[model samples]
Target: MEEAKGFVRRVLLLKFKAETAPNHVERLIKDYSNLVNLVESLKTWHMGKDANIKNLHEGFTHVVELTFEDDEGEAAYSAHPAHLEFHERAWPHVKKMVVIDYKPTSFHT
Candidate 1:
């Protein structure tokens, strides 16, 4: 496979625990939306509750899409203190999560 030599993306799928409160879920989404201001390398951000056919989602309830300039931007966002704090706020409510980082070739989502 050829190397991807362009922008990078971080995609996250979240499933909140059954007992988590609704308000906390709301806050989690807000936190994600705010990262653009706190992290300079964050070029774009989009997050929302899963609206797909309920049966298809299994337990995942939220999807977050983040774009970075490059691998360095991705690394910078990962280690940023604000990002760590955000994780703390969301992790308590998250039952399971899937994270994928890749460079988009034909990607024009």
Candidate 2:
């Protein structure tokens, strides 16, 4: 959707360590959720495991989405102390990750 102001969307795909525990993975998601709680600039947060319908998943098991109100908001998130903490704690458990960002070009309604 196009906004009169502005908006940003972040898509994150994650592949966890091969032997990572299920409970540890769950904690990672929970801690990630806390980033949205602590960052005032974050507009929305969502995440889930891959469906594995096809081989395209490429080992990535989880996906996360974040929405921000503007460029400033997104930038703030990158620099946020809480986010930095989460990044440090989460990176070790992640075998790989893909992050893509975009602004909506059109609105459906």
- By TM-score, the best candidate is 2
Q: Which one wins on lDDT?
A: 2
lDDT by candidate, in order shown: 0.87, 0.91
Q: Give TM-scores for every candidate, taking all chains together and pairing residue i with residue i.
A: 0.88, 0.90
Deviating ranges (above 4 Å) for candidate 2: 1-4, 107-109
Checking candidate 2 for backbone clashes, the offending pairs are none
Clashes of 1: 0
The TM-score of predicted model 1 comes to: 0.88
RMSD of each: 2.8, 2.1
- Measured with C-alpha atoms, the lDDT of residue 93 in candidate 1 is 86
Candidate 2 lDDT over 7-92, as tens digits, reads 89999999999888989999989999988889999989999888977778989889999999889999999999999999999899
Question: Per-residue lDDT for 96 in model 1?
Answer: 96
Give the clash total for candidate 2.
Answer: 0
